[model samples]
Target: MSITERLSRGFVIFDGGLGTMLHSRGLSAGVLPETWNITHPEIVTEVHREYVRSGAEVVSANTFGANRLKYGAKAGEFCLENIIRAGICCAKAAVGDTGALVALDVGPLGKVVGWPGGVGFEEAVGYFSETIRIGAEAGADFVLVETMNDIYELKAAVLAAKEACDLPVVATVVFDASGRMMSGSNPAAVVALLEGLGVAALGMNCSLGPEQMKNILPEMQKYASVPVVVQPNAGMPHLEDRKTVYDVSPAEYATHMREMARAGARGLGGCCGTTPEYIRKLVGALEGITPRPITEKKLTMISSATHALVIGEQPLLVGERINPTGKKWIKEALLAGEYSEIAEEGALQADAGADILDVNAGLPGIDEAEALKTIITELQMITKLPLQIDTSDPAAMEAALRVCCGVPLINSVSGKTESLSAILPLAKKYGGVLVGLTLDDDGIPTDVAGRLRVAEKIISEAQKHGIDPKNIVIDPLAMSVCADPDAALTTLKTVATLSASGKRTLLGISNVSFGLPMRDSLNASFFTMALFAGLSVAIVNPNSAELQKAYRAYLALSGLDENFSEYIDFAARRAAGGEAAS
Candidate 1:
């Protein structure tokens, strides 16, 4: 089955904490060679059977720390082939004809690559390729690259695994307490980098406790286009009797599993300190729950405060504040024919991180079309982030769109006949991104499905006008949360449905938190959640530090942070500049 199909069925349960299980069977912390799987087949088989009996759908082989480097120079002498083969055979025996998956577990190379330790990317790839070859040859179903921190290192491992065999690969990175990789890689950069590398699934494992994972889940789900797996610790390890103890009971741990399911996680498993009972409880808790489907919505790239809406990637934020729609000063400037102020505002937003700037000169006292032309010209001289021509007047939109440099985005076309008739043609003519609102000539639809129908109609009309589906961005129209508790969810559901259609989705995120207390919290949470529903762009107030932080966090968790170097740089700068006050 496809990854989405697997997720939709129910949460896939991976077996719990292997190291702890090994220790429980009288293996000391630094003793008992794990490579003994070749010499002591019966013990390994018994452990695999225990996990199977405890209800694990997948049990990892006992070959985690068995890499050649870890097993020392005697690795060849001890027979690496025999060790790996025996482990897989043992796991297969435990699984029987029930057909549970077996993953060839690959851990880090222990030494850092490049400047820090001199291990080059090719060398690392070669090392991991060896493991992949061994695992595949031993009949492993998939390769699990877990607990990785460096993006380059992870990339090496992924490349090696894919090159070695036809088996699927799942790559996971471990985050530090600060929600970034040890090297400062965040989840967003991780997802972006790994997804581009073609991993079957990407996720976090062996990080902080469930509560911490819960806080980061919204961010994780937002940027992930593939299945997301999370295997958090039972809780932070505590020193007890000279060994680590996790205070969370199996029941308590299962509570977090349910939360993960609700947060859109498709794969659930436990890390350090968990046992088979934990997996059993997790399975029980997630029994009837279904993973959320990707939304099938259309979105248009527009001017936004941060980045330009990338249909399949980052959401382009088009800053709406630069327009003279309702502001008296803006209107006065337009009537007075002052272009510098418009240029200055556009420049400021671009510098502040706007991916695109929305230009509107629709003042009651001015010639809208003429003013729009002048504003667009001036702004073009100051920035290159792209522009979204914003005007209800079709003539003005056409005029500005013609002069705007780069791939311009028409602010909108909609379900309304006039809008569809007018803006759709301009979007098609200019070959630019188109925004579709889920509303008709009558008014906004209150129900999600109605809004979705309107969105579909708008998409059909845009396609009829010769616009590509990828260029269309669908806005579900966020409503006030206080006005109706269900309003936000309704918009989210619409976005989710739109996403599944393989079209881009956008949302004016700040609208959802209107009139609500702690609006930032509400807005940030909603923005993150919308991303999970496949929202590709957000029209948000980029000036808010809280919002920016949340966006950065989301980007990092999504694995878009590259090697996490950006997040690390940001953190280091924050600390050096006293932005992070202790």
Candidate 2:
């Protein structure tokens, strides 16, 4: 059976930290452990055999720091491929025909992108590809990429694995005490991106022990559709008679490991400072415990560098004024390559109560691709609100998606063959909460059922390309009520249709009130109706007082707000002529 199949059966065991074990066996602190694959093959083989004997079902090869970029000039005469091959040879020898797998281990480049100390994304991808190719050729059954903190680097490594070999890949990231990765990816953000990228399994590893892992598991379990992996450190390191020791004993570690298993972790292992005894005890504690069944998470999450916004939990207002459709100043700024105006717009929208900022720099005079990259990078630096990469050009979309620090919401893909062919691959490759416009090659669907068919078609096509339906937010194409009096009703019915099928729905709510008198009142009323119809996200101008009041009222009426506080405050602020009273 494949590792994924075995994972579905029960908790699968992986070996513990190789670095600490090597340190006890006379390996120095700063020495690259991959060097020992060539220098001391017996010691490497012995470590693998000990883990197998201790009940480890997967023994990771001693190639954690084995990439060419870091070790190429440092390993003297031992080439990168030879060292990786040796590491795999030891793992294979130890496991023998016991059905235990040998996973070729890969670690971070210890580099950050666009910084003085980091390498480019493609460079990182090339380095990982070389090592992964070597490990696959050496007969490793799996590829385990661990200790990742940077999402971009993780993306590079994962892409390399999928490009280099057919091995099942499992990715584990290191999180801080604040329960976020180094690049500001929270558990939900990490899960949304990695699962979108199609890893066999995903989880947290290293930096924290079992207690912290327990706190972090709920977020992972909420978003992860795949088998969740949890390989935490035994405990924080402490000094004992000039020797480093972990605080958690094997029994205590196993106790918490059992709790994690019961909580829903199907893959269990250890990180720094753990040993064979840790795995042995963990396996014993979880001997008869069944793996938690995986469930589909109904969340529409989009993220920026520092935060994630889950659309369905509450009404999310996406600032739609960033597009240069009618904004003369914004259009001129985009044409002049002056993003200061664009940056100010983002800040203003964020201040006015927008949860996400919809970015579009598609002016006729500017290069949309370059404009998107610049705007995405700058806007993320200015505000914490996640961005909706709004564009019709595939090149602009791909460019923006690649540079975004977190999983953005790409707007959009449609049921049209040309659109699916162009955008679905980008969504799968770059990872996003892709917006599916409910229109096809034939044009905007005239009725609710037609729009629902297009939305369903978009979901079906996305899944065919390995993109999760949960990652898609459908837009039911709200036409102007002035043009067709029934358009508003049609959109609301379509929203209900998609919501009934467990799909998140978004709408440009203001479009419904176009060319109508008292536009704000019409827009706000239409928005309330859409909310009642299960609208997950509303792309609108947050500067409108009526819309903001409507949003606060909806929160209170839906019981999402506590004590009618938001509605009360909005009424007070409105009564005070939008002025704050100190």
Best-fitting candidate, measured by TM-score? 2
Superposed Cα deviation of residue 491, candidate 2 (Å): 2.3
Clashes of 1: 48
lDDT of 2 by residue, 18-64 (tens): 98898889998777788898889889899989999999999999989
In terms of lDDT, which candidate is strongest? 2
lDDT of 1 at 556: 82
Model 2 residue pairs with clashes: none
Worst 10 residues of 1 by lDDT: 299-308
lDDT by residue for model 1 (1-582), tens: 433345456677888888787777767666644555766667777777777777776778877766667654664646666667777888888778765788888888887753345576567778888878988998888888998876556767887887788887888888876777765566665664555445778888886777788777776677666788889899988898888899788999899879888888888888899988888898889877777754423333332111233456664566666666546788778878998897888887876566667777877867888888778767754565667677789998876754443356667788999889988876654446777888998799999889988988987887787665767778889999899999998999998888888877778788888887898888888888887788877776666656666776777888878887756765675578678823
lDDT of 1 at 182: 68
lDDT of 1: 0.74
